[model samples]
Target: MAFLPTTKEEMQEQGYEQVDFIYVLGDAYVDHPSFGCAIITRTLQAFGYSCAILAQPDWHKDEEFLQFGTPRLGFLVSAGNIDSMVNHYSVNKRRRDQDAYSDDGIMGKRPDRPTIVYTQILKRLFPDVPVLIGGIEASLRRLAHYDYWDDKVRRSILIDSQADLLMFGMGENTIVEVADALNSGLAVQDICYIRGTVWKSKTLDMIVDDYILLPSYEQVRTDKRAYAKSFMIQYENQDAINSKMLIEAYEGWYVICNQPPLPLTQEQMDFTYSLPYERTFHPKYHYVPAIEEVQFSITSNRGCFGACAFCAITSHQGRVISTRSVESVVAEAKTITQMKNFKGYIHDVGGPSANFSRPACDKQQTHGACAKRQCLWPTPCPNLKVDHSHYVDMLDQVRALPNVKKVFIRSGIRYDYLMYDKDETFFDRLVQHHISGQLKVAPEHVSAPVLDKMGKPRKELYLRFVDRYYEKNKQFGKKQFLVPYLMSSHPGCDLNSAIELACYLKKIHHTPKQVQDFYPTPGTLATCMYYTGLDPRNMKPVYVAKTYEEKLEQRALMQFSYPKNYEIVYRALKKAHREDLIGNGPKCLIPKNKPKQNASFKQERAHRQKRYSKT
Candidate 1:
């Protein structure tokens, strides 16, 4: 047989008139050649079950939908990528039992995309075809979930999405079995028998069979804000690890699907890394590239090593830097070069603090860098040695390819590790090839107490790097500058610290254009801080900008706090009879006249309730 037979040839061999099944899906990374979708889809193919990858579907446009496409035995509904994006997940932020403002977002808004809602339409159109759903989103939302902003418990999204069956957690293992059973002409409900899935009971009521819920993730409430906060905490802290599965006694006859399919073995990881992933992104959903600023996206690693107090990457992929070999990376780079717009560049070549590969440190201590949580969560067994030298060689090779322009490292790099350049370092070379005019780094905040609370270091370290950076920029006559990403009003950021940060930023001349106020996401250390006013990791009291007014002041400062912050500060000073240092001396970082509290959530809710009542 020919080494790589055409799709038609493979179809001929099957001797079947139709494909085994088709996949209507969603995942954080769509390039089927990279993530979990890659494994599941490829495995089905090996079993003679054909599959199509429909990344994030725009149900609004019937043309883009696949409800009427060729029928098959069944449809596998995977939500890890797409559902997670819609029902965004975060490792850290804040969580409240009640939500005062949660509602279906407006028309044309992203979170409200009609995929699941329209999946119901798919059911109407193809009434008999099975629509099985599974992935992180379905897994996490398998039961009645509390929406903090809405301040109400929302039903399982799996139920709402109208999937025939919902599976959860790392699904590489369960999906294969589901595919096999379907190919054998098994009933869709038969899939519920598999572990790691959620389906209806025989009683015709929702039966949420046990699905794996990482301890870190289970803590999150469904409010979108809480998810973001959770994400930030999970991304911080160099030595953070991952959380374990929880099997409870009180959920009622629930089977604890606590066993997440074991981490993808190296061979499986290699198979994914070697796929022709570059072309996997369906060009129809073109906005994906626009938002990412890259024609195509790729992944180098599946997980993160740094379990920051505010990040959730660990919660999703675990702390181990499960990676593909350099050879596999090279193969992917070759495919990316063949893109039609094939501008001589591979969009982004990294994931989760891209610079560090397979953490060199052990889980116990920090000789290198540890992404461990004090909670003894399963992080990369710290002693996992990272060989960045391979990356340097890979970047050099990628740039050397024909038509390959500057290979950009658009994925944010961990500034802390970049600063820890050993023996002249990989960062120096990384700067030349990957960084454009400026390397985008996330040194989230500058306040010491805030930094500690966020599992980050002080502002001095960021300054030290900046000083050295400017000196180099001047020496080389390179106008390339550094854009430092900052956040305000996180749990530890009080008005004073926010003001100090605003003033310090102005003094440095590198004022940020993008400023994020602390959004309390579910399952994050920072969110816990907002909820309890204490950093969970450090057990220290911290500032929580809980009230609307305080959140407003802190957020306003991040944007020049009214371009004339000094004026606001001056006014306050004058009112205190301390006018001596107004114009001639120290200026303030806050605005002179504070804006009136908008009370957006309260007003919006009242307005919505009134409108609903009118109806």
Candidate 2:
């Protein structure tokens, strides 16, 4: 349960002459299980590997990476839990001022593209040392991917970073297997067949003929459509049971990605959670803002089945839900209550999608999720299982525990999936107990066309959920609200669709406090659509707002209530030929501005009224 050695001095104090693996990270050393570094390092320790953390090492200097001298096993690097480019910048490509993962919540501690930058540094320092890259940045960019920040199709991160190997997805099983292989004195290049990993080879003779061959890096670079096609092929083969080996040629080298490993079984889930975690940041720091939110929270599950187009969860965590037993979760809850500052509250107990406690259907376990179709999109599959009794029972057990005031499910709930269920027992209780005055749901947009492009359920389902939510709240005699998370300028969203969404917001008297412009990060269906202007699913043309001004206008339309957005909204309305929304009327989005002559007349009328009142 002690903190891992973060320094050479700490390593010496721990009675280790040589460390096994030195983990280089983009984030501050937070030992919480929510962090991939914490989980991977703890799992390695459980298997008797001496590991040390080299978190947020200064990238500009070579001395920072050599602190541990050199690890006996290898080097493990991650760009923290999130991609470094995403962590450092906003959707507008503007620099973000604060990093929640940093101590004191300051930015600039980690370099942009930390995985590539850190690995390149490691390769420079010790050329012979094995460097393995993983985490979101490495996982999503494992192949030739469109880089939004750079605005180019970059080669797979392994090609750029020159790291010997890359592991994708939740890498608990893979990392250990990698350590065992490397510890046995096998060459890094010789260990290429492990699941959930990407390895580079100088030639194609090592690749199996049956493995899927994506369009070469050269082809995908010049052809945006080819990139989309390649992304679809990657998407279809994410499942462990049915996935094929994939090989993509990058010039003279081949980047081979073996099939994803089987999802952790319930037993594995229990064991992973049971690993000793300090459940907070290393005590040397004063404050880690990320810990405050997750200190009392628990991740009851992993992965998500809601394959929304903009999400990377399907690619990172896969669509299959791997869950810990109710007993394991409750045991963690009991441990939380025993903490010194144990508040009466359990902040959250959920995963990628909170309510997805189990797989979508029974068949997914043996046959794998359907590659071509979604579980709860367009429409819920006929075989989709819709039960919440187990989740409700688990929540009941936690609620009944001593010293626990309230338990919340704050991650998110798929409202459409909730509505699809025939039973409503969980719904009534969710409103009564779980909601902290408001429940956050992501409707994304109100336009059916845009929703279709986003692979979300129709607007009709959201409307029904909205109506039923209020009714349920009324029954509970509690006043609560739904905070709808809205996005603008996604693929298939034009100025007219933006206006339609603005009108719907007005109808509901809702002005969103936060508006998210579509951020096309790597390895997403939406990102592919954004880059190609074509839906990879069917190669249908999609309307994409690519220009900065057009994207700003779409975002402004979502929050037209602010005076600053008035000009942009006005321009959008005018350009869309929806001038009807620009006039001074009840249904108008913005008032049409008049010329100086009208202003003078209004001033004269105001003066007359003032003079008459004085007389």
Candidate 1, residues 539-605, lDDT tens digits: the string is 5566676676566566656665344344444443454454443343345443334445457745876
Model 2 CA deviation exceeding 4 Å by range: 593-615
Estimate the TM-score of every prediction: 0.70, 0.95
User: What is the C-alpha RMSD, rounded to one decimal, of candidate 1?
Assistant: 8.6
Could you give candidate 2's per-residue lDDT for residues 66-108 as a string of tens digits?
8799889799999998888888888877777689999999899
Worst 10 residues of 1 by lDDT: 97-106
Best by lDDT: 2
Q: Which candidate achieves the best TM-score against the true structure?
A: 2
lDDT of 1: 0.54
